[model samples]
Target: MITINNEPTAYTPIFLGTTQHSLRLSLEILIMVGMKLNDEIIETYNVSVSAIELGQLPDIGSEIAIDEITGSELSGFKAKLKQSDAKIQNTASTELEKLVDLKNVGRYQLLKGQKNMTQELNVPTLTNDNLILMRQMLGVTQKELSVTMGINEKTIRRIENKEQGISERFVNKLLAVYPELAQIIEVQFDWVSLTFPDLTSKQVIDDVLRLQDNLFLERPTSQNFYTREMAFAGEKNIYIQDFAPFKNPETQAIEQKFGTTLYLTGKGTRLFEKALLEQSMNWRNFFEKARQYRGHLTRLDIAINDKWGLLNMNDLVKAVQEKRFWSKSKSYAVHGN
Candidate 1:
């Protein structure tokens, strides 16, 4: 009989076959045990006396000496039974430890598998999410951003949603405001292309008048006849001459009479090209410097020239004094240039 939860439970039968393949009538012994809680059928068998001499019975089982009436003999039998019970208990404990270890290993493997699955199923990219984050970081409303960028708010919404393709012009406008948006969007710098709108007739006239005012402010006697002619030519969609009346009086008189001159050789044309090239190069240098510095500054302090020959060198010294600039300088010295 076996005890479970302080109650007697039945032991089930275990069959062991012999080479003879026939039941041993002398070995048959009926054994009775208690039923388990689940009402499972139990059977038991008694060990044969002959099988004990052949070492078929386990050494831990109880041994009974027939007709033994001595107290010493009875005490020896009880000690052997206790030793057998201890051996069974130790075996059971060792098996329980192995099962616990296997369970822990299985749980760890399951967790690791779940982690790998999550990494594989991660989202593709964050282009749209980044666009929204950038817009929010700038602290500008969609309508305000549209006004500053000269684009419709609907277009901005579409870009944030990734539902519509972004045009180069719009991209450029965004970059101008938030330069780091390029890195966030994971777009190559050279892929950007911008097309500026042509000036309207009224805008041309206004620009010409503004230039006239500037020249008049600088020199009251100067009529800025060259600027007026260029404005008129621009309005008429005709090419203007490159005559510099201020520098050359003869060319100026001839231009005043002809009302037009070749556009290429004009001082304004040369100045315009030089300014444009300088501005473009400055922007390129600024981006390079920003990259070298790892985006440290909020604004670039590089010098840039305008079409009217206006030079801006407001913060060049401060930029050079920065630690990042010194680091770059050291690297350049160590290298060839």
Candidate 2:
């Protein structure tokens, strides 16, 4: 049933197919029709929602012949037209409400999905000091980090300055913005590969050993083909190759293309954990040196083994399927059950 001037109007064939599934699509059609009818109806009349709500419909006022609207027939025609107009208004209002509700639902779902994605990714006893350190290591100012992390600059400042204690919500938001931080959160590196186009192997080795007064690692040992290799106790090792392998034309061409002149690689996590644990290796200084030497970072890997089972891949997939998340990937695929 539909209301018309406080009276109920039943569904009829005349109103069938008048409503559209998509209110926005219907609005587009109405706009197009209004544009086309501009010449015919422009400046002739104006109607608005307020007018409709106020029941301030325009007067018919001698527009129709007196004979055409006479007695009971005229009254019936007037009632029917009023009923149709009221039904249209009600339908439009309902559809508009639906559109607003849909928008709110989408917003809620997206936030919920994001929460689910980061709820378990705790930063393991995060503190104001570490937060400051992370920001400094990333080489971003507080304002720049706030913009990138989607957090307020004032909040970041408060947290870093010890005015506010670190909260789980803040850490979750931080990790959501920078999941890579999990790997390097504690200033640890799992694997690092650097190529120096200008510096010799000896120069690179000397710089590494001199970083912390050679207190961590033993002296370098000669390796087959490779110039030198240094190792801390355990499985951590740094391998250096003074020259690129140009065994064949193909290898030489590959080296030329990639520019692997003097390759240096530090592999395994124990190297940092044992050897450089107490060392103050300024990453900014290292980056500046690399830039000075025109070195290339061929490979760098960061990963966190979720031994505590913090990550949920299933929820991530669900978020993607529900279109409740944003991504840079052109496309995503779901394999297996």
Candidate maximizing lDDT? 2
Candidate 1 stretches greater than 4 Å from native = 1-126, 179-337
Q: Write the per-residue lDDT of candidate 2 for residues 74-193, one digit (tens) a residue.
A: 342212233334433333444343332221211101111232222342334666877887777678999998998787899999988899987768877877887655433111234566
In order, candidate lDDTs are 0.30, 0.40
| Model 1 lDDT at residue 114 | 22
Best by TM-score: 2
Tell me the tens digit of each residue's lDDT in model 1 across 1-337.
4432244434322211111111122232211111222332232222222222222222111222211111222332111112332233212223222222221211101111122112242222335665565567778888888988888899888878789776646656776765434322110111111111233222222332122211111111123233433322122111232223334465544322222221222222222222223233332453353344232322212111121111233444445445436443353222221
lDDT over C-alpha atoms for residue 145 of model 2: 89
RMSD of each: 46.1, 31.2
Model 2 lDDT-worst window of ten: 29-38
Model 2 stretches astray by more than 4 angstroms: 1-188, 208-236, 244-269, 273-279, 305-308, 313-337
Error of 1 at 319 (Å): 36
**Model 1: lDDT to the true structure:** 0.30
